[model samples]
Every structure is written in structure tokens, then in C-alpha cells.
Target chain A: MAQQEFDTTAFRNALGSFTTGVTIITATAPDGTPVGLTANSFNSVSLDPPMVLWSLAKTSLSVEAFNEAKHWNVHVLSQEQQDLSNTFASRGENKFAGIDLEEGLSDAPLIPDCSARFQCRNMVTHDGGDHLIYIGEVLNFDQQDLPPLVFQQGQYAMTARKPWEGVELSSEPKAPECSYNEDLLGYLLGRSHFQMLFRMRKVFDEQAHEDSHFFALSVLNIQANLSLEEINDYIEYTGHSLTDTDIEFLISQELIEKLDDETYQLTANGRETSLLHIAQAKAIEEELIRDLGQGDVMALKLLLKRLISKTDPGLPDLWKAKETAK
Target chain B: MAQQEFDTTAFRNALGSFTTGVTIITATAPDGTPVGLTANSFNSVSLDPPMVLWSLAKTSLSVEAFNEAKHWNVHVLSQEQQDLSNTFASRGENKFAGIDLEEGLSDAPLIPDCSARFQCRNMVTHDGGDHLIYIGEVLNFDQQDLPPLVFQQGQYAMTARKPWEGVELSSEPKAPECSYNEDLLGYLLGRSHFQMLFRMRKVFDEQAHEDSHFFALSVLNIQANLSLEEINDYIEYTGHSLTDTDIEFLISQELIEKLDDETYQLTANGRETSLLHIAQAKAIEEELIRDLGQGDVMALKLLLKRLISKTDPGLPDLWKAKETAK
Candidate 1:
């Protein structure tokens, strides 16, 4: 197959679809001086040992201070702290000159009314692209319930606690198109290990001779369109107990019929029986519902139903019906 | 060296210091059914190919729909779209019961008034732990100038748009029990790419066999009090560079004194030079500021400085004038 080239601009813009928080790491120089920089590359690496990590460019001046300092601090900004994000990000001579701060554990500077704070020791450095990873072992920390500042799509933003109402009041834009088949399949497999059954049938079909008597009746019991020989091979693959006697009994009852030597098929009556297989899928669905609770399940189901309707305009009653019964 | 352990919770909480935006992924099933799911694990992979990627749990029902889907839609939440996030995250049969949506190029569901939207074709899938990575080729997308929803530390947060009118702050913590010498040494070496100078000194020292003049000078340059031959190799391992001509120049300038062929040391003037090196670092702190304009840089810097001060109660002013200037 010919390879298709990938467009990174479109891709990055696509991924920018998700938003994240912003932070600034700060440390003191040897002569008791402070240095800092803004970073969104910060992440939690461990919790038990009270560790966190952030990445800085190898050429950053603050990096030297951080590496040399006995301790450093991380500040979580509140939605009202946009000015703070700007200060540390600028090339100013005295960022803290007019900033509000208080002394905390080990005399660390703490901004009043910020969301959270973490004082830590440098852990180790890791190699990142033109950057050095700094892991900090949190020695002390604190937090408030204030809202946090967000960053997405190259812009600073804030989180909204409320849900979206029916109408588009703000006028942002439409989302990109995406197919939901894969998500549905994933849910199916998770809910009912059906993929195992599908694979089993394939394996059984491979083992059977060109024309041979197999568990044709069971295959008919599941997916009735298959030939009797195909059914037998599938039964073998799925490890279901089937014998020639059962095949004869099924034939006698008119649930199956012989098409030719080593070839057989499911009768009309057998096709009707397979509808129960779909019902079997409900057991898994019910289990998921029970685990998630009625409210959560209802939410997920509704979202999915709406999404499905977007694809096929005809599923007008998808939400109205509990099950899509055949 | 002994192996060290890290704490995951502490790390996560520390990194939660940052905030980000939220978005929902929408797609259709193989048989033309629609489905959608809430996701924050989306990020830009590349810009040139116009490709974007996100990870879906292998167990998500929407995963299956997404896999066989011809197109997918992404909806970036707005500041007022908290309800939208809740609706998308909840499990229900009629998520869009009272919602308004428009048809895009592929008839993909467009959540009206979102911060942004992107329609893309399924590009590729890669195996991830308990998830599959789906890459998309963005066909079309849109955006609006509105704040996006953000989630951090498992809570909703908004962007901090301005600096708090407050007092200046400083580092509070007293020095740790551990001596600051190692930190000082690490800081000095991190300043410049002087490793080549160290390499030249290494070659000369090996050849001279007599008290290597180059090694003696490097030790004196940084730690003037150290006797040349008595300097520890462990300290030398961290040093980056020295040159024979540089060493000779320092001695000629009375910056160092050679006690004998086997002994040498730094004079008073050399110690003052080391202090000046760290001071020059402040002007070029934001080396990692990529593809950002001056306005963005200033805003980010200001915000970062404020946040850092808020987080570290013991942080001192990183820039302090020399009190012992000659």
C-alpha cells in the first residue's frame, strides 16, 4: 500500500482540542536570588515518595539556579492569576518587586491567594528534547479551593463548572468530524468478550475439511447463514461440545438441512433462534450499568445516542427505545 | 549508587499545579450510527501534516464506532460549557434531547457555540495500554475567541487573567542541614558549555604528569581557597573546562599563585569572577519560549512569576545586587 503523508499543523491543531493547566517553577540563586519560568510540561511522576517533575530547556538560566539550589518551589495558579503567568514568563530584571508574597516552610516565598504550592528538592535530570527534566521530591505543600488557570489552543483560559445548555450562546465553532464505530466496538468487546467468540469461529473454520460434518447446528444456533460444515468447524474452534448425533437430530427437526456431501445449512427455524444472541449482549450492558449507577449510565447512553443520531439522521427514536430489538 | 523511589500521588498533585481545557470527541458507527465521548487526553503530534491524535480506552463503546468511522468531530468546550462536559461525560439515552447541532462537511455533529471544532478523517491507530491511539487528518476546523473549560487536580478551573495587586515576596526557608556547596557547584557548571575547555585540560594534564597545570587552574578559578593538588577529583568530574593558555593568563594576572611544581591555587581576584558568571544568566532565562510572540511572552512571564511566588513561601528574590563590590 502507498503511504500517505501526515500533516503536523492539522494534527497539532487537532490535539490542541484538549486543554490543560499552566504553572511556573521557581528557585533561588546562590546569592539568595530568585529565578523562575513558565511551563505547561509539568506533570506528576510519583505520589508515594512525594515526587513531581517538570521539563526546562537545557539553555534556560533558571535551569542553572534550579540545579544549583538546595530547594525549589512550584506554584499552581488560580483563574485570577493571569498576571502571574506573564511576570515569570517575561525577561524582566525584578519580577517579584511588586508581587504579593508570604514566607512559608523554609522561608519560601508564597503568593497570597494562589491555588496551590509545593516546596521540593531536586530529584534527578532526564534527557528530553533540548530540555532537562527536573523531578522534585515535595517537602511541603499547600492548596486552596480556588479555581485554576487553563491553557489551550495557544491561549490562556479558565474552567467552567456548569454544563452546556441546549443553545450555542457563545458562538465558538463546530467540532471536527469523527466516526464512532471504533468506540462502539470497544464497548461491545469490554461488555461481552464477543471478540473472543468471533475469533473462535474463524479458527474453527480454518481447521475443518473442505466438505465435512461439523457442529453445524450450533453455528446455526448463533449465526444461521453459515453452511453446516462451516458451523461444525466454528463449534470446534469455540470448544463447544457437538457430535454427529446432534447434527442428525437438528436435521430431523428441520432446524438444519444437508446442502451436499460435507456441506449443510441452517433452516428457516434456525435463523429465528439466533436473535437470542443479541439478547445475550444485554447481560454485559446491564453489568456495566450496575457498576456505573443509573444516573451515570443514563448520561453516557444519552450522549452516545445523540452522537449516533448525528451520523444517521434516521435514528430519530434511538433515545426513545431502550433496545434496538430485531 | 543506590536506587531511589518516587511517590506517584505527590507527583500527580504537584503537576496538578497546571490547568487545561476540555473537549468531546464525536463519531459515527460502521452502520451509520453516531456516538461521542468526553476526552482530555488529546494533544498535537505534528503541525506540518495537519494531523491530530487522541487516545481512547479499549473498553469504550465509542471506541468501536470511532474505528470504523470515516470521519470524526471534535468539540472544544467554552467557558460556559461546563454543562456540556457534564452531559458528554454522563451516561444517558438522550444526551442531545434538548440540544442544538449542525451538519458539517461530512454531516458530523457540530456542537453549536463551542470554543472550537475540527472535522477530520481517521488516519491511523496504534496500540496503547488498555487504549488505542487514533490519529486524524484534519479536513476542516473552526475556532472562536472565547475561554475554554479547564480541568486540573480533578477540579474545574478558570484562567487567571490578571495579576493580583499585592506586595512583593521573598524565599522564606532557612538553609537545609545539607551544605549548599554541591548546589553551588552544580549551578556554576550549568552556566556555560565549557566541557571542551575541560577536555583540553585533561589532555594536557595527562601529558604533563608533573602537577597538571590545567587541573590546578580550573580548581582555583571556581574555588579559590582550594589547594591545587588537594582538590577532589569528584569536584573536578563536575567541572566543564580549562585551558593551558587560560591557566597561564590567570597566573600572570595574579589571579592564582603557584606554590610549587606540585601545588597551585587561586588568588583573591579569581573568586570575584565566579560570582559574576551567575549574574549574567538572568537576561536569557526563557530559552524554551517557542513560536510565541512578544505579547504572549510577557503575559506568560508575568503570570509565571506571580504563581511561583504564590507557591513557594520560602522563595527569595532571585536577583540581588552585590553588596561587596570593590
Candidate 2:
């Protein structure tokens, strides 16, 4: 629809549809004060003489300082720096209070642990209606392996990159009428979960442990001194249960021991076994992070957490403070 | 590190660290020919005047047309438009051949189904090193609910928006020594998988079916007339097996019938039940899509498929053409 009438809110929302990486632009005022603010308007301009540009509202409080500055540093924030973005975006004083600044080419304040940093010399300022556009010549730049933070539709985000050619699990397509296909979310989740557990099972198999025993030990690892019934409560959703025979097998292997109160705890050997399991799990995760970038892994975890919360079956919270105290 | 020597490759890679949404800027050449190219160098400049800016390399083939054009349209590409992004980014002739154009305020070719579209009157063009920056005053704009496509470090991506506060399964922190915490990818996947299944179980309960029977029907739905042993082979990874008792149960329920040579095929009733199960699964997915945006769900599925491929344990391919042929 073509609009002759300008609704500011609608215009802003329309602009927000364009996603961007979060950036914090820092500059040193003539008085030697560091001024910074969060802006997603940063964009790369030229390559030969390397240049970039960003826009700021004319009414911004730091506009004067940025205008007078000869140089500024733009920090392409990493996913871990969302708080830093919020801090600089606000009107709070001492924005750099707890920040450990790093030395840069110019006097502009350099923030550490960014996905990338660009030191630029302010080249020109153009007037655009109610904003000032600052074009800068990149003097120096460096990039890290951190996953850049993303912003779209007024929310922080992490990206899961698609391979250039895309990922396909099956070479052949399923029959059109076959409702159960590879695209089914349930099938994907089930297959992914089982495959991961399959990897963990190799480690468990070495100790002559079954999936149920491993689940039991994992529960004890989080909340110790749980009775058999309590342990089953946590592991029941997995469709695996710890039978008396399985508990006896674990005790024979010295992986677990029962107390007088009918509560079971991991023996020292059991704790070590559990730790080894965790190490294997961590190793598997590292391999996945290597295959999929850090950002994709983070996004997967975020989505999984959301899914878990939404479908929670009222099971006892494993990481709850009250549970830990008990 | 400050670089006095500019390596174009390194500079380009460093610049890529700043992620951006893909856009296709289109304008009709002086001879009434449509010219368009994909660009990521776009950013909002002013709100009061509703202005936006994008930069074009001076060496671009379309530079002459863009320079002389008095109006242009900026389309913020949606995730589904990656193919279109690649098409426009190329030097191919007739980029507008298959594209359905929408009527706009100007002669600029407006593409449909973009995350957003900005029809603008050319405002000013500024010089930035080897690039020419074209600023436009937004005469009209519109936005859609589709998720925007993201680009970072030379790859296309989809974003999973983080809530303003963040997602937490529990309010309290786990013990530092607790090896099993919420961040474990395996634990997250397993929990997410089971929790989703638990919701489906409410629907499954109505049919008086357990998960294994559901798995059996799904396998048969994909490849009909599979023997019990073959079906078990397909579903073994899920810790499910089909036994004579299970086969008899299916027969009693008229969900499946024993064919010659001891192979089993889903009866008409069985196929209908399987379709019902798929519908419920799709319903569950729709609710998830509502909670987590479409892009996030798609990304999760992509990642899960990748994970399944990586950790695949030589399970029988259910969707293999040869199997379907049988």
C-alpha cells in the first residue's frame, strides 16, 4: 500500500523490519570524555579506501561530542554483549565505569571482546532531515570469532546460518500423501535427540550401563540423595525407568549406593563416572559447535529452552534452589 | 591491530563481521529498463523525514542507471527470498523476468512478499571513497509479518529473536559443580523432545495407543508392507521395537493386516490413524510456531537435521526410494 500520510510509529516499525547487527559507537569528546551509544544504523560503505557510515538523531545528547570528535571506534557487539548494548543505549552516566578499555590506534574508547572493531577517522557529515550522517574512513580493523548479536523488530536475536546449498537429510523425497516425512518437526526432534543419546550410549555401554541407569545417575548428579521414587519422577518422561534390578546392577558396579533412608547417592566412583559422562557430553557439544557455528548452537539452545518451558509436564524443577537445598 | 597495509580480502572479511539484512534496490533505467542489485549496505537515516540510505560501488555496472534515476524502491528481503537475492545479486539479464511487480508511486519496480518495501524519492547522493551513497526520502513504505533474512561473514542466516528479558527454565542458578545443567545440548534436546511428545500423548491417549504403536504406524505409513523385523530396524533408534504381541495388538485394532510372506501393511483404518497422528503433530508444531516465530522453528529444524546426519548410527533409511518401491 502506498501511503501519503506519514505515521511515525508505522514508519519506525517498517524500518525495524530490516534486521541489523547491534553496534556501539564510541568517541572521545574534545574534553577527553568518552561518549558512546548503541546504534544499528552502522553499514559498510567502500572497500578501496575502506569506509563505513552511521546516522544519529540531531537531538541526541552525544551528538555534539561525536560531531567534534576526529575519530570514533565502532564495536560490532558479540552475542554476549547485549547488556553492554543496553548500557550504552541508555542515558546513564559513566557508561564505561566497569568496562576495561583496550588501547586503540586513536584516542577513541575501545571496548574489548567485540565480534569486530573498527577504528575510523571521521571524514564527512551529511545532513539528512532530522539526523546527521557520519561517514568514516576505516584506519584499522580486526575481527574475532564471536557470534555477532542481531536485532530485528525491536528485539535482540541470534542467527542460525544456512549453508549456501542448504541441508538435506534424505536424497529422495517422501510420497506426497505420506504425512510422516523428514520435514515433520516431531520426527526431526526425535531423531536428533536419539542420535545424540546414541553417542552418549557408547560411553554408557563401556561401563555396562543402560540408558535408564545413565538417566538415573544424571538425576542424582543434579539433585543428590533422591529416593528411587523421586529419581523415577524426573526420568519418567524419557520412557525409561530404573528397575530394582538396574539399581542393583549400578550398586554392583559401585556406581551408586543406597542409604538407610532408602535414598540413593552416587558413590565416589559413581560421581567420577557421572563426571566422565558430562565430559563426553561436553566433547560432543564441542564437536557440534565446530560443525555449526557458535551462534547456531546458541540459537538452538534458546529455542530448545523455550520449547521445554512451553511443554513442561509439571515435573520437579531439577535446577530449582529449593530442590538443590533439599 | 592497526593495519597500514590494506588487504582487500581481509578488509572485506572484517567488514562482513557486521551483519546486515539483504535488500534489493530497483529502479527503471532511463530507457525504461529495470535495473536491480542485491545490497546489504542499507540503513535508516532519519525518522522525521522518513529517509533511508544505501551505498553502491562506483564500479558497479548499474551505477550509471542508479545515478540518473530519480526514484527507487528498497525491498528488505524475507527469508524465503534468498533465491531472489542471489538472482538480483548476479549480473544475469532479465532479473525481472519471473518476478511479479506491484504498483508503486513511481516507475521503480516493486517486488512482492518482502519483509518490507520502501518507495522513495531520490534525495541526495554523497561520495564515500570509491562508493556513492544514495539517500532517499521515503515517500511510501509497507511491511509484512515475514521474518527478514540475515547475512553475516559471507553466509545467509535466519534469526531467533531473544525475548527482551531472556529465556530461563528455572529462576535459580544450578550448583557450579553440578555437571548436568540446563545448558547441556543433549539434555536440552532430550527434554524438548519428550516434552513435545508428552503433549502429543494427550491426543494419543484418546486413541489408546502408546508411543511404540504410533512409531509402528508412522513407519508403515512411509513404506508399506514392511515386515515386523524391518519396522523394528527402522524404529530401533527410538528405543522402540515391534514384537509379535505388538503385531497382534495392531491386528486386533484393525490398524494393520498381515500380508503374504509375513509382511505387514497398514489397513485403511491404520492409514487414517496415522494421518490423524500426523495432523496432531502438525497442530503441535503450529502452536510452537505461534510461540516461536516461523524463522526460529525453521532454523531449529535445519539444525536438528544437521545433527541427525552427523550422529546418524546407520539406521535404515525410511524414505529411501527402493524401500518405498517395495
Which structure among the candidates has the greatest TM-score?
2
For all candidates, the clash counts are: 168, 0
Q: Lowest summed lDDT over 10 consecutive residues: which window, candidate 1 chain A? A: A179-188
Badly placed stretches (over 4 Å) of model 2 are A1-3, A174-178, A321-326, B1-3, B323-326
Model 1, span A1-326: residue lDDT tens: 12445454544554454676667777778778878777765544344556556667677777677778777777877767778788877878787887777775544455676677777777666544356556666777777756566666656643322222222211233222221111122112111222222222343344331112222433344343444444544433222344677667667766567665555566776444333322333333354445433322332332222222222212111112122242
What does TM-score give for chain A of every model? Answer: 0.46, 0.96
Compute the lDDT of residue B213 as modeled in candidate 2.
96
Candidate 1 chain B, which ten residues in sequence have the lowest lDDT sum?
Answer: B182-191
Q: What lDDT score is found at residue B235 in candidate 1? A: 28
RMSD of each: 35.7, 2.1
Q: Fraction of true contacts kept, per model?
A: 0.17, 0.83
